[model samples]
Target: MITFCKYALCFAMSIKKNNIRLLQNQSYSWLFAISLLVFSSLSYGQDTSVSQENDANKPVIKDDFEWQIILDLSLIYGPTIIAGIEQEKLSEYLMPGLLVDISYKGFYLQSNQRRSHVLLGGTELGYQLFIEENWQLDLILKAYMQGYDSESLIEYGGGDAELLAGLKEREVTIGAAIRYSQYFEDALFRIDFAYGSSGEDENENHVGGLIIDSFYSYLLPYKNWDIYLGAGLSYFSQDIINYYIGVSPDEVLATRPEYDAEAGFRAQAEIYAQYPVSESWSFHTGITHSYFSNNVKESPLVDTNQTTQVTLGVMYVF
Candidate 1:
């Protein structure tokens, strides 16, 4: 535990300059998370047994939190999608994210296509609405897609500044979501229905959009490597489309004509590999590709029809 705290402080001191990140080929995030939970539980059980046996002999330290923290420092390479992002790009991949695995009851943020910040212990603020043997439902507060704006563009991909000069900044949001997860022997299927609100429209009206994501992931039980394959489709509503990538008449320029985005779909495919070097160290890498539909491609604010993310990194588990 002392060693773990040292690692935690080390991670914090270098959080911004750190280059490694977890390659969430959409599935490996949960895959590694689950593995950490299993190992943590086993460790805690052993500790508890020893404490019980020595109860009368000595004072045993009671550990309140039995959790695993992983530092995934990845060097990611990917294409730029949103305009005005080149100025914001610090490296090849804009930025890396840190993930925490705490043993708390809540709905995990399933698959949100939009790029958002990873909130520490963010998945803990959820209540289980229903639970069965392999299926469960939860109402959760999670980081939702902030629509397309400067921040997401900078981190995920970058582009020309002039092209997006006149665009409105979409605010980031954490909204409510209903998630359903199904577990199988070697796979997991999840669906999320979420809503995000950034701001009011030009008509002084508040508006929000609905997003539905369906994700399926399977794990290959390779003795030497942890391999995950994932595919998913995210459906965006018209309001969400326009809020993020669409154009309105008030904000249209001569070069960028007014265009309303039709509700459309974004498809993603991911493959990831993780190899454990020892009990606490491992090397991991993966690639994720998401293709935007014509509705999104047609947006003047966006310059690319697809985004590809690739990462090579090392993970330290304590």
Candidate 2:
């Protein structure tokens, strides 16, 4: 009985030891799994923080500005009168002008003025919708007024009894246009086209026709300056000129005029350089050459065709 009791104690001891080992192995396995889970979560959180920081440092792009303005002046020296039977010498005239461009987001207002045979003022209100980073489309309503002094009119009456008549004409033009601009490392290119009809009795009678204008410009590289070159062409029918000049085929025939203009065209070429000294100040110098068709140059009564002009001015941009 004693030997059997001793053997039973030994067996009991061995079973207890094996059971403890098994429990320890299971506890270690659970602890390892929990640790691995904690490490994975910590790694994910760190990556998220890094990503958010990068996003916070990203740059923002702004496509709107407060306002901009441009002023221009030109000295026009050319033939003020041309007639078939006679020709007039070239004369010089000072044409000072201002242009203001006010913008808020996509809306804009523009006003311009110049002096020539007539003092002219022009205004436009438009909405500029940006299609891309460099391209914009505009829908604008434009109006212009041309006022001339009585002395500016061609004298029809002879010497002491000469009659001087002054006239004021105005026109409203509404049009839509697309403008495309491409930016380079140091230069910019812009191209635009616009078409509109004039609305005024005088414009309809004398200046009536479709008006189209376009421009192309390339900026100089690496300077606060740019050089631009452009050309323009306009055609006017007999009806439009007759209304302003007071000479039509019927009227000319009735008066038996020795020479007269029937219809005409005007062409222009221009080159200018602009330098910006500050956000609100600039200097500009330019030259313009204009040519008028034979119909206008050969007319006996009027002679403002075929002229060349040069101008230098300082501008204030707002």
Candidate 3:
């Protein structure tokens, strides 16, 4: 008994040491990101000053924020596939609900499409922290859903004794994100870091995680249409993967064993097009595909390793 106790204590100490090291590394990464932003902003400021002096005779375009305050109005409808679910007949296909976007100057808010039956999609609000001709930065807030409410999953054995005896409502994750965008003549590159927090998972359990995403996009303009292609890689923390997808010991049954998901990566690609129908009306459509990593794919709750999303809609600029 004494030897066992000593071994347990040593294991506990090792875990604590590892946690501290992880925290230090995260802090260093954040510091480095902030430093880069500050340096870029200073350099851009000086360049802007020089350009103003060179173009003194050119008429400055006054921002019409006071006159045209509201930014965008749109309506979108589309059929999308929700992948990686047990009940394909009920949860695989869906018609997206209302979509809206509003913005002013550097601040914006938008709703995104749901990719899974377990999720309620999310709302993203962002404010530009810094902007220049080729570089821009934003601070963002996103409200994300982690799992399906028991009521919604009733068809998939929500209250059944064997499969979902203790299922509950989806956990909401509110994330604070930082985004950096770089613009080229016909391409754009973006990187994002987000820290997510969750209050309770119906069991009153607190959860938190982090994500990092990097993407590159290219545009092709032909006639009245502009087409875009984009690709990206995403990283999710272990805490997030576990809370949303992993199975717990108590919740495991004969068929579903306990699972502990680790930090993982995902790859994504998208193609979209926009065509102007008139001065105020425009049509837009896109399709996106995401491939999950083995850590996520190994979950018993998952049925597919990849998911696809498609949307078609129209927008009105006011």
Which candidate leads in TM-score? Answer: 1
List model 3 lDDT by residue over 164-244, tens digit each: 446444355677889887777677776779887765543567778887867776776665456667787878788876776
| TM-score of each model, paired residue for residue | 0.69, 0.52, 0.63
What is the RMSD of candidate 3?
18.0
1-318, model 2: which lDDT tens digit per residue?
000011111122324445434534554453454345434433332211110000111211223775555554333332233222111211112233456666676677755221111111135677765545544456655532122222222321111112222223222334344444444443333333444443444223524443333323333322434555545555544534433344334334432354434655566676666544444444455665667666664543454566655554444544
> Mind sharing the TM-score for model 2?
0.52
Candidate 3 lDDT score at position 155: 37
Candidate 1 segments exceeding 4 Å error: 1-65, 83-94, 105-125, 146-158
Model 1 TM-score, 2 decimals = 0.69
lDDT of each: 0.53, 0.39, 0.50
Per residue, candidate 1 scores C-alpha lDDT tens digits across 110-219 of: 22211111221133245567777777787766644533443333333343444655566654445567878787777777777878555766676776778776777676
**Deviation of model 2 at 125, angstroms:** 2.6
List all candidate RMSDs to the true structure. 11.2, 36.9, 18.0
Preferred candidate (TM-score higher): 1 or 3: 1
The CA root-mean-square deviation of candidate 2, after full C-alpha superposition on the true structure, stands at 36.9
* 228: Cα error in model 3, Å: 1.0
Ten-residue stretch with the least lDDT total in model 3: 1-10
What is candidate 2's CA lDDT for residue 292? 66
Off by over 4 Å in 2: 1-65, 69-96, 111-123, 129-135, 143-207, 221-224, 236-242, 245-264, 276-280
